[model samples]
Target: MSRYEVDKALWDVYRDASAAKQYRRDPVGFLAPRDLSDEEREALAARDVRRLVALGSHPFLTYNFALRLAGGFSMPFVQDYVGQLQGLVVGDITT
Candidate 1:
């Protein structure tokens, strides 16, 4: 129920190189200190963008974070990220 924390986590990686490196090194560990629900932690670790969206994280941040996870706007990753978000509509984003 904490979209603020969830989106902060996404933004951490999306905007900071150290955070992104930490994420690549240890996804769970990187998020361990964040005030996120277990479900949120699992979703982020698993890179489950759809689940994150459903959890109310900002879709734009989620998409950008996915690109970071895919090593910066590269192939296959972009396609995979796109697939996860296919046929989608952004829902309530209030945090």
Candidate 2:
């Protein structure tokens, strides 16, 4: 629904998908990581998504924001999303 909501949802999914074996290998390192409640996750997601949407021509900006949000960027995924939006905007501008 909102940027923060999207981010939080994505984050929750990411957390849930993390392998326990990884944690087993380094319990203290993994467990020491921060925990984000559903509500907080949603709020942060919404904020980042909103910022991305607001950037207009710089749709790719969201990827950076998303990374700054969670830690790092995934270029393939971010580029895909940004490229799609940029295409749509270009179409609109041309018409």
Candidate 3:
């Protein structure tokens, strides 16, 4: 019910600093207005990249979101993103 919304949230989290701040401050509040199912809402609130991918969110979006969560794109944080994505099983990102 919320694949597109999930991707949109990820894109916002990646591109908009204000959105990122709001998301970091309160993810459930940030997502409250979106057309998200409970599963999608919880995954976004949790910043669960693996769950996002499994739900068909684009890898680029999830990767960038993970980078932001790790506090930037340094190699160490990128590695942490990679770790967060471990065991990912991407089915189809096309919504």
Best by TM-score: 3
* Predicted candidate 3 versus true structure: per-residue lDDT over 8-83, tens digit per residue: 9999999998999999999999999999999999989998877888878899888888777667879887777778
Evaluate model 2: give its lDDT: 0.40
Q: Best lDDT goes to which candidate?
A: 1
Q: What TM-score fits each model?
A: 0.88, 0.26, 0.89
Off by over 4 Å in 1: none
User: lDDT per model, in order?
Assistant: 0.89, 0.40, 0.85
- List candidate 3 segments past 4 Å from native: none
User: Residues 1-95, candidate 1, lDDT per residue (tens digit)?
Assistant: 78899999999999999999999899989998889999999999998999999888998899889887776766787788888888878778865
lDDT of 2 by residue, 9-94 (tens): 33433454353334334433443343544443433334434433433213333444444444455777567556545634321211
Error of 2 at 20 (Å): 25
Prediction 2 TM-score vs. true: 0.26
Worst 10 residues of 2 by lDDT: 86-95
